[model samples]
Target: MKQPLLDMRGIVKSFSGVRALNGVSIQLEKGEVLSVCGENGSGKSTLMKVLSGVWPFASYEGEIFFEGSQVKASSIRDTEVLGIVIIHQELALVKELSVLENIFLGNELGSFARLDDEAMYRRTSELLARVKLDVLPDTLVRDLGVGQQQLVEIAKALNKNVKLLILDEPTSSLTSTEIEILLNIVSELKAQGIACIYISHKLDEVLSLSDWVAVIRDGEHIATKAAADLTQNDIIGMMVGRQLDELFPREVHDIGEVILRVSHATAMQAGASRPQVDDVSFKLHQGEILGIAGLIGSGRTELMQCLYGCYDGQYSVNIELEGKEKAIRSQRTALQAGIAMVPEDRKRHGIVPIMSVGRNITLSVLDNYKALFGAIDEDKESQDIDDYIARLKVKTASADLAIKNLSGGNQQKAIIAKCLLTHPKILILDEPTRGIDVGAKYEIYKLMFALVKEGVSIIMVSSELPEVIGISDRVLVMHEGKLKGDFGYRGLTQEIIMNCAIKEGA
Candidate 1:
């Protein structure tokens, strides 16, 4: 048999005495693509870290072999010398730097005495062309969209002459078209004899891009099989240890009378020719899961921000609650008016990472726990925090652990818990499940159902059509800051939503 291009045997990794990877192993041939699928904390990222030398050689018990030779990588740089590269989920580009500058930031060409700008530019152009990104070499990274930046990351990897590229949740934030472009780029890379270890929660993308699929559950490698032989159901079963019979657990409930209405909501930024949200007016009823569906730049998030009193630019709106006109000018005012929002970018806007999970959950209601002389009622606060953590099923080693220590899905649930603590009549979830795994997504969907059944209105802005259609009672489609269509869930379809989003409602 031909020797495999890469082999990993008996990989065992632990974190703080807890095993995160237990004797997991995988093998790949030249020009092949392997996808690792698992839940958020199922050791997928841990294993990848070990392979890329982020955990270093002595940190884990593993034997790695590449090109029929034993490998020992003490650092990421050591592995990079042998053509191993990893692109993390959170992009590592300097926003202020130009494309060419970022690509050669650490690994500049030419002699140590001086840099070679001309050579770097030419190489950057070639790398950009290879990745199919149509941008000038001098364009600033900040001006590029998320999709463009992702392509730039790949170009950086190519510049390293990467033989085995490991992508961790690469398409988690990309639009459908962007995702298609990236998948095509991966196909091209494979044709050039570059092997890849792709990790993501998106099962369809895995099945389409990979030759083999590896499933891990709670730090244990379950199985590996040819992608052609495994369906999405099979992968989900292995990842979660059971068949997730329904991807979306839709619930039936009655939508009450309109509790809130907005008229002529418009938000505009400085020097921008157009409003981000242009005269979009809508009504949200009690116990209703009103979904806002649109493409990435369709102003779904902007509209929600307007309602939540957090839009950064100038805004004008007429909001009514229970037939009474109200003014909501800030997040504090919005919360006081019985409206709460869980933002799109959670790491930046939702939680204080250094704060404990219990404290983060109680952040919105800190005043509610105030005692005499402005002292915090620690006993009451602790009880309430415990209750919310249990109620939300936020899996944490302990409530005292920093919120950053939890996985993306658990952090999201904690954010939701914080919102629920406000006892808001309306809740806004902007891309709440953006990078979360399937198991967590299902749990969040179930929680949404439970919330709506209790008369807490919800406005969910999502880029995913299936999620919007499956969990929403009513769908509102937006396009270019305009409300294009409104349809009842009884007969809603993704095709109808997209048609309205691309043009006008038909």
Candidate 2:
């Protein structure tokens, strides 16, 4: 039998005396794609970190054998020198740098004396061609879209002469077209005898692309099976330790009077030829979960930003809030009118990472805790923060800890708690469950139902079609800055939503 390309045995890791990976083992055959999947805190990333030398040889208990040799790597560069490259969930490229500069940032293409620009550009051009990215070598990273940035990341990895590539949630921010391109690249890499370790919460992608599927739960390896023999439900069962009969836990809520109405809303960029959102009109009902579904750049986010008064572009929105027409000129105006929005980019726009968990949750509604002489009431603030921490089930060692210290799901919950503390009549969530695990997603879904039951309206904008079809009471589809279709979720399917989103005309 041929030796496995990578073998990690008896791997164990911990943080603060708590075990993150307990006796976990994984193997990858030469040129094979092994997918590691689990819930948010299930230790998948920890295992990869151990292999990539992020935890180092002494920090974790494990025996890593690469290419029939026991390897002890003390740093990320150590593993990279051994042909192991890791692309983290967050892209590592510098946005201000050009493509060629970012790709060769650490590994320069010249001797210690001088930099070789021409040689680096030629090599970068070849890498970009291999990855099918059609952009100039001098293009700034910031100018490229998220999908393009991901391709750039891959190109950078290819320059490292990688024998095994580890991708963590690589497609979480990519669109359908970009995902297809990335999967094709993986296949090509496999054909060239390069091994890959793919980690993602998207099960369909896992089952479709993997040769072997490994499930880890609670720091333990649940099972590893051939992809052909396992079904999506089987994988989900192993990840959560229970059969998820229905991915969406639908609950019927009483739909009441119209709580919000936007008529002839339009948002225009300063130098663009056309408006980002063009003459869109929609009505949101009380106790309703209204889902906005569309492809990327279809103006769904722009419409929401305009409604929330956060769009920098020229825009006009005539809104009726609780049967009274109001003009919202800024985010403060929108908040004063009882409208709250959870932005799409959580790290950039949602939470204050350096702030404490409690502070982030109560940031939007601090005025509620103010007492005599404009002094804040510590007792009331603590009470409200504790209430939300328990109510939303945000996992943290303490409320005083920095919000960024928590996992993605817990951080998301904290952001939601922040939005809820404002007591808004209308809550707008842009991709509420994006980048979170399935377990956390279910919890968020249940929370949505509870909120709607209490008469709070929700407007969710999501790129995931299944999520839009699953949890939404009604869905509005947009294509090319136009509302193409609006339908109830009773008989809706993903195909219907996509058809509307891709249709040529209004």
Candidate 3:
């Protein structure tokens, strides 16, 4: 039999006396696609870092055998030289640099004496073509969308002569079309005898793209089986160590009166030919969960931004809040008028990475804890923080820890706590569970139900069709900045929502 391309045995890694990976073992055959599935903080990314030499050889105790030889890599460069490349969850490309420059940034394509621009451009073109991307090499990285940027990251990996490609959450930000394209590229790479290790929280993608499925839970390997023999529930059961009876734990709540009404709302980008959000109108009720569904650039986010008073474009919004007309011009105005939003890109817009957990939670209502002498009341702040932490079940060692140290779900909880502190009548969440694990997603869904029961209205914008149909009281589909259809969840299906989103009309 042919030797396996990679073999890792008894890998043990720890941080500050906490074991991240314990007695984990995995093997990969030539050209095989192995998927790593687990919940948040399950040590999936840590194992990949160990394999790719990000944790280095001396930092962890493990034996990695590649091509019948034991390998000890001290750095990422060493692993890359051995044809083991990792594209991280957070992209590593410099946005200011051109595609050609970002691809060959550290690993330039020329001799020591002279630079070879022509050779690098040619190689970049070929790599882009291999990934089926048609963008020019000179295009700036910042100019591309998240899905396009992901394709560029893959093209960059291909330029490294990658024999073993490791992708961590590559499709987290991609649309359906982009995900299909990326999966096709992975298949092509497999056909060319390139091994891949795909780490993702999206179980459906893992089941579809992998030849071998490996489940890890709490830093331990639970099971590794053939993809054909396993189902999505089987994988989820292994990852969370229990059967998830349902993906959406929806609870019934009594939806009250119409609290918010917007009529003829239009938003236009500066110097643009046409309005991005054109004559959009919607109504949101008290104690209701209203879901907004659309494609990537369907103006769903733009409309939300305009409503939240953060849109940079010129917008005219005629809104009635509880039967009273109001003019909201800025985020401060929106917040003061009982509105709060949790943005889509959590890492970039949600939390202050350097701030402590307690600080992030109480950031919105700091004035409420101020004393007459102008001194901030630490005891009150701490009490409120502790209360919410327990209420939301945020997993953390202490409130003093940096918010960034928490997982995606925990960070989201912190942001939600911040919004709730403002005593907002209306809550807006954009892609609230974008990068969260399955377990965390359930918690958030339950939290939404609890909020609505307390008479708080919610407007959620999400790309996941199942989620939109599962928990939403009603769904509004947008197609090219226009309201295509409004659906009730009773008889709603993904097919109907998608048809409304893609159907052509003025």
Candidate 4:
């Protein structure tokens, strides 16, 4: 038999005393694409970490073979030297650095004694062109949008002479158009004989890109089959160990009188020509799921930030809570006034990754757990934390485990739990299920219904149009920071929403 380009055997990784990967094994050939799919916390990313040296050799029991030779890599650099590269789910680019600087941050060109700026600039330009990213090499990463930043990361990867590549949820923060560009880039790379292990919750992309699909459940390899023979339902069934009939489980809930009204909200950045949020006005009712839909940069997030009192720029808003005009100047004020928000970038703004899961959940409501002379009431706090953890069905080894160790879906649930502890009358969810699996997204959708059934109004800002149409009682479309169309969800479709969002006067 011909030797495969890469082979991993008997990969077993444990955290503390619990096994995350149970003797998982797989093989990949050159010029082939293998997509790994699973539910959240199903050990998909863990398996990739083992192969990419993120978990390092000797830390786990596994045999890795590259080009028919056994390999033991101690660090990511070691794997990179052997033509293996990985782009993590969470971005690793330094915000302070420019695109050219980030692409060649450590891997510079020229002699040992001196660096080559001209050579580096030329190579960066070539990489940027290869990735179809129309951006200046000297452009700062901080100034770019999330999708642009994602492309920049891809550009960085293409700069390396890689034989095997790994992408973990690369399209999680991208727009649909940008997603297509990325998919095309991946196809181009496959044509160049680069083997790729694609890990994502998006099964459609998996089917479209992969020559084979590998499904894992609870850290165990389930099955590997030709992508041409497998359907999305087949993959989902393998990942979750059951058939999920409905991806979007929307329930009927009563939408009552307007509990909150936001009028003429406008947010302006320091150097921008126009406001981020332009004269946005809307009303959210009791027990209502009001979804805000737009392209990523259409100011949906900015409007929500303005309402939550977290917008970085100058903004003015007139809010009426329960028929009384109110002022929300900060997050504390928003929370105190019966409003809570689960921000867009969960890793950056929602959770403190270093903190324990239990602690992170109760962070916003710490004052509620205070006892005696400025010390936390451990007993009461743990009880509340446990309750929320159970309520949200967050899968973790222990509440005391660092939240960073949990899956992306679980981390999002913890952030939602933190917001819920505020007991807010209205909840703001921005990109609530950005990188979550289909199963987890269903759970969150069900939870949204449950919350609204309990009289908690919700305003969901999402880039996904199907989600906006499915779970929303009403939909508000935004374009260029302005409200373009507000409609009942009864007859709403993605086309109608997109038309309104893209065509200014539609």
Candidate 5:
């Protein structure tokens, strides 16, 4: 019989008065991957925080035994020193720095004297090779797309000679080919006796890669079983403590007249290599979810940006709303025309982190509630904010609390709530659930269904294939600034979409 590499017993954690983890236990064998599967706010991340020392020894009650020795990790550095590394839900690479610099950040070698440029780049190349990423070591982090940046993060962790690697939603942004490469890397790591704690909302990934599956729900451990032993329904039942009827509940609804029409819309940067978004035309019908699916760098985002009037691009547009032609030269114009856009980068573009939750929600609709004398409407504003907070299940101490205090899921919900108040006819959600957890994703899906039922046309651009397939009535696949394929929801498959996205002949 072989000894286990990692063992956590009687783990308990809390935030203020709310218990996040209660008496959870897990075990991992050397060279095996143990997947943690749970809904959002289910304490999977909290348990990982405890193990990685984000919640220090004194803050959480737990016993972590690594390599048959009891260890109390007081800081992230302490855990790192023991060859344990965590790649957080939000990536930690310094955008301004080069790849080599980011990989060696805080964990720099040849430290006391100065940085060893030659040695660092050499090691970085080796690590990159292991991960199947062939980019130059000196490339800036900011220049890379989300998927490429994720590979860089993996390379950074591997550069630490990590024994136990923890990945949170690692493949969320990756393409299918990239996911294959990552899975191969994980298998290679396993061959070398390295262990992994894979945390993800992606069940297929968890089932495919894991040897054991641990389920947690509402701060308590439900069960841990072999990956092959549990059915998909079995896992879901454990996570939510009930059955999820449909991942994409596409209830039949009538598609009315075109609510939005964009003709020959173009967005271009001055003196750049061709326009960011070339001449494009599309129409969205009321009560319809039109999903835009494309690889990163496709013109999908730029088209949405143009529709929302987010930039002063060399722009020429013909747009129609509700049978009337309208000009949207600015964000104000777009908002006035009953269009709302949820930007892709929620933290930077979609939210005001330092602002109070109430203020952030009311920002888009301030004029409607303003007093006739131009005085502020404090009481009404507070009430509206509170109403949204309750409706969206936004977890906040109070409406007055800063937006930065909420978790990623809660923040995303707040953003949706903010947009909902605008009474938008056409809602543009660009990567709406990019960094959100599964439970939050379910909530967003339900919200979308409800909105569609209410006759609000939605244009959603998503990198997630399952999401696009599940929720959309129709999908548009883009390639190299062009629409490559268009299909009704029932007619699309992962294989068909992939072929269209990469097929130059198409």
Candidate 6:
């Protein structure tokens, strides 16, 4: 019986007519790591936002007790002053700024009218060392990869003298080594009596690190139990309110003839230390879901980019479609060849945030929805948009709503629907379910099964082992810009795949 460090009672949050969190309650003890589990739109992030003052005092109805005192935070500054900090899924670092500058961007070292660069840099270097990123303090954020950028975000949080840290999908983009370092840091923090609220879809890490677990379903608190008392299946059951029959609905299909093939693919970028893709060669056949598994910056993205012709270079990658060679030098060519790519960052590259759902859904197939002599057919577009919205089960009032109005999971479904309209033969999905919730992940997996049944080939790159193992018919492990091993569904296990990902002798 240690006294609870923080207690949230009767939390109720709403948006318009929809309830995001309804009378949910939970508690955190000093030095305790409590994991909040829920699918997308389940109110986990919303709860964290409330705690971190992203929602502020008057925005929601709740009583938050911190250190035996009722606290009302007016803003993020107030929350930080109470020693509570949050690292969001979409990092807050400025790419153009150096590591030290980004870390101390708002919190400068000197008194009100002066700047102290030396003190800031020295403190930043110490923080970086604590996180075990020995890179130079002057290195710009854009110069670092996604994994390193994640560490920078954590370091930024540590700089705030955080006592209660809320991390939303902190390891989504980290490498195996980086993940271990972060886990170690959490252990150290706990020893010093710092509490943590880790929100992640990565169940293995959740079970390993969390002392207690709380599950939320559809904005309702389901249960809170000790880590040892609950299993992964129990967490899933609590989150979705039902037992999931299978994690991945993988089906066996006859392998068809080679539909897409890449040979000797190479990309050269300035000052990258190594080629982004080094003579990568692989063949993708019809009715196949080829999964490319790797850590961040291991060249999976670059390989796909090269195949889609997004890089600038004298690359010599031979492509064979229907047993004949074809030149693909641009994105237009890739799309014309019936290849559709669902990029990694949906907000940045996948969709137009401000546009209507109808417009976003019909953007890819607009050519087909046009009348004679370049006239756009509004009726046809509306009908097709309606069909996709229903098909994807997008939770929206109507197709006329702004794309930004939907939740992250629904936004992802909209992007997938947009790609489906292209009716491509080969589909490339990069971290398709990165920030989405469990129910949304199930929907995406079902969609994939339906697509594969229709003879479309899929190339998925994911950091989640369950996703890679569950959905892929075959897994290709990439390490240090090269394919290290390949495993079929029948022969693959998480342990073996991880071993392949980090082979002997580096």
lDDT of each: 0.90, 0.90, 0.89, 0.91, 0.85, 0.86
Question: Candidate 5: which stretches are off by over 4 Å?
Answer: 1-3, 269-272, 371-379, 395-401, 435-442
Model 5, 135-233: lDDT tens digits are 899999998877788889989889886899998878866777788888888888889999999987778888999999999887798988999997787
Q: Where does candidate 1 have its weakest 10-residue lDDT segment?
A: 497-506
The order of the candidates by TM-score, greatest first, is 4, 1, 3, 2, 5, 6
Off by over 4 Å in 2: 371-379
Instruction: Give the Cα RMSD of candidate 6.
Output: 2.6
Give, for candidate 5, the lowest lDDT window spanning 10 residues.
434-443
The number of clashing residue pairs in each candidate reads 0, 0, 0, 0, 0, 1
**Candidate 3 error regions (>4 Å):** none
Better of 1 and 5 by lDDT: 1
The TM-score of predicted model 2 comes to 0.95
lDDT of 4 by residue, 368-415 (tens): 878999999999999999999988888899999999999877898899
Record all residue pairs in model 4 with backbone atoms less than 3 Å apart, i.e. clashing.
Answer: none
Candidate 6 — which residues are off by over 4 angstroms? 1-3, 271-273, 312-314, 371-379, 484-487, 494-500, 503-506
The candidate 3 region of ten consecutive residues with least summed lDDT is 404-413
Query: Model 6, range 440-473, lDDT digits (tens) per residue?
Result: 6887888887888899999999888878989988
Residue 184 Cα positional deviation in candidate 5, in Å, after optimal superposition:
1.6
Error of 3 at 383 (Å): 3.2
- RMSD per model, one decimal: 1.8, 2.0, 1.9, 1.2, 2.4, 2.6
- Tens digits of per-residue lDDT for model 3 on 1-506? 77899999999998767787898999999899999988877788889989999998978887999888887999999989889999987787899999999999988877967889899999999988888889999999998999999999999999887999999989988999899999999999999999999988888899889999999887899999999999999988898878889989889899999999988888998888778788999999999999999999899998998888888878988889999998888878999899999988777777899999999999989999999799999999999999888877776768998887665567878887888788789999998888788887888899899899999999999999889998899999998888889988999999999988999966
